[model samples]
Target: MIRRHDVTPAQFAALAAGYGGPETIEALARAQLSKHLLLIKFIAEAWVGARAHRDAAVETLTRAQAAAPAEVAELLGSPLVGAWAADCTRRLRGGLRAEIPLDAECNHLSAIAAAAAALAGVEARLEVPSFGGRVAVPGFGLTKLDGAAVATVACGRVTVAGAAQWLAPRTLSATSHGRSIRVTLDDVDPYRGGHHVPPTGRLTSVDGWQAVFAEAWDLLATHAPARADELAAGLRTLIPLQQVDSHSARSATIRDAFGAFGLTMPSRATDLAVTLVHEFQHSKLSGLLDVTRLSDPGATELHFAPWRIDPRPVSGLLQGVYAFLGIADLWRRLLPVVAEAPQEYAVVREQVRWGLTSLEGSGALTEAGRRFTSGMRAVFDDMAADRVPPELVRRAERKLRGTHDAWQRRHQTTDSPARP
Candidate 1:
């Protein structure tokens, strides 16, 4: 049976104020997991009725479920599994073309079942997907095979014939002041593709990632304990993106793939911390959106966003406001300690203020959206009283106006300014 998920008024307010506790995150996760499971069920039923020859995979998964229900459920709960299932469902529904052969596409479930059986110590042999001599076991690592597409699980061991190497799952962990953060450095999953950029194929050494993540976690745990806790509870995987440059990094979060983000390696831990807080805000809001609709879907009005050169829809504006609110909060906590905190705080806080102003005047907000924005306004009002240097505030205002003028000149329109 599928479970119905609801967000209470208080929880909605807390989440809107950018303060979702672990419990709230877990609730969102449960809702996402349910959506994935329903997709899987729909795919299975459709495949069976159409005689898609997917029974072997279904049988394997059923046996695994009977032997170890929790293990099977856990395997299915992965974000990549959801991505794969969503892809398969789309293909079956004619929304997407069949890129791979139907049988090969359906075999991903067999791969998942094989992983679950291996985890549960159930003996089984199954045909799974092999890409360039590597067979990935979801939730685990990859096993290198010469040319085999079959996986055999016996006596608590999973092996592909003539396998020469095993790449165990790698994770980065750090602990500071009783707070701990651990996340998988996932570079092997083929389904980790929704984040615009492809994953950086398996890393030779995770030493660099480990050191950077530790430093980043220390900063977060020491200063932003609330976000640290949120990360600890919700974040599961980090797909490494190709490095763009020494000082800058790009990151993104997909709406369907909860708890995972694609991020390039940044040179400084401070940048990584800021990126983490910023991207995870997107993740939180994405998860919340899955359970509830905050904006009118039919609304088409576009407004200037302080961070972007182009106009954004009301939904995009809401997402930016929530994300930059977290960024501003992080910088606010780092003030006077980090060398760049003062200017960063002033800039982002001004951006947040600009976004909130636009959002308040937007006519596209639904009832829920209005309440959510009201909660955000309350938080911003509280933070508005926090002191920033007079010089920095002036500089921020100048930059804001300069950006607005540039946008106007480029777009060739004089819409109302996004600022007060």
Candidate 2:
């Protein structure tokens, strides 16, 4: 097991400042805590809403049951919490109409209860049963989902059963980049719930993903060791890496969660390496945002996003810039490593130039957005002076700006700003 260290705010600030170095495992672990806390906080909010409705229901039930004293009171006493919890689960499910399993429902409530107890800053002596209950949040402490002692906030402890230990039936460890991380072959996402869900695609069997993961890691370790090392240092887990059998490679990266999200492993190692670095950046920023807010909370208006075909909110725009920082950084570094592969080198070089151009058109950010992005300012500025042909740089700039303008013309609304 890796030794856990206390991650400081200053460390996160430096990351937000855009310093180039491998992200310490401790820091990544802290960011993971922020994600769990945020998820817990969300459930707590839902629980509070559910309780409001439940209290009224309970009062009405009590009045009706008053006709029969002993039997009715016993019924009420036993099922009160369970009934309220069920109602809260329904409310939390929202408009999604699907047959949710009973275990899933109970687990959902348990998660919320844990979060609520933590938020209340009180001791939670609740034992929650779950498929895999592992709530290990850095600084906040560890909780197991399985055992009777599910959570103890007073002592900062949580016990999660199946979920924590069950990444995949088949798992492997790879530390080629100087740090160890678990690669899971399962297709089911452990973090699936809330607004997050599994993506649609052909699932890669254990054997398929294992082979793909091997190829991907080999490429990273060989061609982009530095980038690989950075990822190893920061990304401690990979899970439910399902394969999408598509004609072309495609991937999705989510912040606030570790591991790839239905991310397709590309055929080319270079592509895989670049994709890993790109998505990992999103994961890093998500963790950072858990502790620090970059965009104004009130800036809810959607705006044109250069990288995306659709208009995005302030949060999306900020995420785009931050993610592109890593994208550019990867290609900038890889360009030198792939010198022998002229075709690949040229592609990396263009990607770096285009990423910079895209970042520039990312529109106006809030004060925090600007400050947070300041850390990356030097990196982008350095890439600006790269020896790429002036025409290639100009072409990339025009293409990116043109795409943004076109998207705005097609989708911009009265409330939507001209730029993000």
Candidate 3:
């Protein structure tokens, strides 16, 4: 566990620099702080306007506090921290909601609970019943903890199942196409939902994530073999997954934390394969950014994003470009594999072009961003140089350009237009 005395700014920076690779003790300490401090900020934010949920939130915080050493607890409870949390929460509320989202509230609260359990030298298993008519156990099997807690917080109930005998987390290992990965079903991400507090309903399915993961791996092996190896090498853990139950689309791909990847069980191997590549891109960039800040801290102007409804900051633009670098590569490889599906191929081709154009327009990246992007540009150009059907290129360029132009007119700041 990371005690307050063990962490220094230099150590934290080193950890960020290492990203998620095998790190020394100091780097590991920094990783823990990076993950937990986010949760702590959320907790402090939720404490205000907790109103009806005050007891649950306070209980969650108190338990976490009691579990940690005095120094850690003081850091968590500092008045400055509370004030900061309040300010952040107010901004997050955006005048639309009175309090933080329920799932976020529960997610952070459970993070606190999990930390408390870890500090007490015990392993925890969670059972969360969502109001949405399903129950979920993110870390089902009894497993050793990684100096952190596993907790389930919902309106229904959040309890510690029992202790794991092992001292490290439980893992599932699989190999395919001569590549292997260790999938960790542990409590690593503190801000995940599906394990929520009461009054919410979620459809949580158990006993099937392994099959989905295996299938996804096979698809990668067959189609994008090289990227699969990169994934296997870069990825060390996989968090618990849930079923997608959205109204618009029945599937979702999420990369919430720097290294943590989550997916709604995908039916199509191709879908899963693309998601793996997409989220892996985020993980890689997150690790890189930890070591280096790629933009001025004061660069907070929101800009139009082709993929989003709301304006995004320079950081978000950089992240999008970095992530799409891999996405574009994945599609470039899969293009030949899905040749039979002409319509699908068209979309994939457009994605490649769109990704390239977005990277070209990715504005004013910091020195680090420019350095990283220079390498990305090399690969992107290599892919771009590949000859494609001229008709396909024309069609895709038109479609992608139309999408970007339409999005700007609708979403970009009109009071002061964005640079072309």
lDDT of 2 by residue, 150-176 (tens): 444453334443434323234645655
Model 1 Cα lDDT, one tens digit per residue, 1-420: 268887777778889999888888888888878888788778777774324335666776777778878777767777778778888888888888855666566677777877878877788788777766677778767877766477788776777777767676689999999998888888888777666556687789999889989999999999999999999998888889876566656899877778888898767799999999999899889888888898988998898899999889999999999999999999989995799999999999899999999999998898999999998999899888988899999999999989988988999998874458
Q: How close is candidate 2 to the true structure, as a TM-score?
A: 0.61
Candidate 3, residues 289-356, lDDT tens digits: the string is: 54556677676566555556566677776666666656666666666766533444454545544543
Query: How many steric overlaps are in each model, in order?
Result: 0, 21, 12
Candidate 1 Cα outliers beyond 4 Å, as residue runs: 48-53, 144-148, 245-247
Question: For model 3, where is the 10-residue window of minimal lDDT?
Answer: 194-203
RMSD of each candidate relative to the true structure: 2.2, 11.9, 9.6
lDDT of 3: 0.49
- What are the models' TM-scores? 0.93, 0.61, 0.57
Q: Rank the candidates by lDDT, best first.
A: 1, 3, 2
Please list the C-alpha lDDT of all candidates, in the order they appear: 0.83, 0.49, 0.49
Query: In model 2, what is the error at residue 339, expressed in angstroms?
Result: 6.9
